[model samples]
Target: MNTQDAGPLLEIRRLTTRFQTQNGALNAADDVSLMVGKAETVGVVGESGCGKSVTSLSVLRLVPSPGKIEAGSILFDGEDLLSKTSRQMEGIRGKDISMIFQEPMTSLNPVYTVGKQVAEALLVHNPALGRKRARDQAIEMFGHVGISEPKSRFDTYPHQLSGGLRQRAMIAMALICRPKLLIADEPTTALDVTIEAQILRLMKKLQNETGTSILLISHNLSVIAETCDRVYVMYSGRIVEESDVFDLFDRTLHPYTSGLLASIPRKNSAIEPGKPLHSIPGGVPDMTRLPCGCKFAPRCEEVMEICCREEPTLADAGGGHCVRCWKFLGRKAVKV
Candidate 1:
């Protein structure tokens, strides 16, 4: 389904999350805006410290201590999440929206059995289900998420499970309540290739079955390409480009996006023997002391004097593709 034609399930506008560090206030997410259509899988891709995780945390109003959402709105199902009271948010989270955090080992409680944790999620939103029913449902979900011998595995502690099973348990916890939206932050991090592929496929299958919209955050472009319908390319603390998966790869406009694509190792393609893989020069700038103009200007190979002098707004460059770059400033929007 075309996201433009369908109403958005979640819409974030001008979100700015700030952290008060000893050095200065840092904008972890700056004017970040994106949308997830119903049942659509959207991806946020960028290197570490680029604010991808912070943006997701902001949406759930779970930004860590000393970090606050200074501005912007997060609209979910036409309701402003930012305006909701903590009590109201408690009602919304897990039932309406759930997140599978980056690391299962860290996110999952070591003290609790994986089954009990997943069951608790259901119990939180549906107390009437009772412990017996909740346990049954959690086990069913574990089976659905591909856990072998769900009944036995459900009783195991997070430390007892392998990384893949821990991840599956996390997914079961997030999906048990059948939330409308699932925010998966680096869900496959540290998994083997086979496990990663399995996890991605399991998510896709579950999403299809439940019709849940997913906002998948990852630095892996290959993962994004395999799963997401649309892509949002984040930089220092801002979205540098937004496009459908096909166009983002086929007609990459932003220099940073191009650099990222170039960095990916291509299989079955001719390559010079012993050639070094392409890498974007320079690390993400310190948020507190970002460059005066474009955050990426210092590393951008096609940087212009104007690029270094003025920050560019995210402007449409046709076919629903938006880019924040000096080069595409005056280009007329063209429908594909």
Candidate 2:
């Protein structure tokens, strides 16, 4: 095992997952690869239904039974997670790699008290721990995640807490055992701005303190830019672009990445106030019936003849950047 001292904490290589739907087989994620180094944070950002959530779920082999990982591997600490059995994965989930879902209200057990729920997580991984010791550990972890009066909050039910507190509770539950890596899928979606900032800061601090790698998935481009060191932009089911945070925003190679950055609101823009937000100009093509060539070509502003004819491979484009587009191919001099 590579562990946290050296190399990547979690390495996902050419991971693909598809569902055999009634309509046809739907490709949720196709040949996606990325790395999360020890104590590093990598954000995966894309529009909804762009396979952001599915990629993270695939990391833990959590994708539904109907869907299958047809290719690639999830290498966690140099151990291929995809090769692990169900019982083996269960042991790893809370102990080595924990995940925090989007909605706390729905994700947290409604019937169990907050403390009891987190305590259960501790107990699950450590069968030797009795209920009282588990309860103490849960309270300590909850406090570590910034919950106020952890003792009192522990006994309260999930429904009794505010949305922000509930999210904190989720983080506490996920981090109770100090897992080596954490996957947060839009963890701040339901919280207000202040709470969002607090949670982000808290997670960052914990990452620094504990050296936990993070795989953060969100549609919020701004959050991705701020929190992540490297980013992977997904379109349709494939990774269309990957670059460092600054390169992504300053010198984006892919047209899809450019559009996403340009779509962010500006304080003093030249365009009229009523102008519509610049969407990609088309719905994401159905995965089951994706276009033959570059999946994003249908919505691309700089469409080319080759785009519809062949799927472009993710190729090195320069200075630590990779992009999949026919535009990168130098055109032959036209007979003018």
Q: Which numbered prediction scores highest in lDDT against the true structure?
A: 1
Clash count of each predicted structure? 0, 0
Tens-digit per-residue lDDT, 1-336, candidate 1: 112434799999999999999999999999999999999999999999999999998989999999999999998987789998999999988888999876896668999999999999899899998999999999999989999899999889999989898999999988998898999999998899899999999999999998999999999898999999999999988999999999999999999999989888889667788999889998889889999888999999998888889899999878999999987783443322
lDDT of 2 at 162: 93
How does candidate 2 score on lDDT?
A: 0.87
**Per-residue lDDT value at 196 in model 1:** 97
Per-residue lDDT tens digits for candidate 2, residues 150-244, read 99999899999998899999999889888999999999977887999999999999999998889899888878887999999999888999988
TM-score of each: 0.95, 0.94
lDDT score of residue 18 within candidate 2: 91
lDDT of each: 0.91, 0.87
Q: Give the lDDT of residue 123 in candidate 2.
A: 92
Pairs that collide in candidate 2 are none
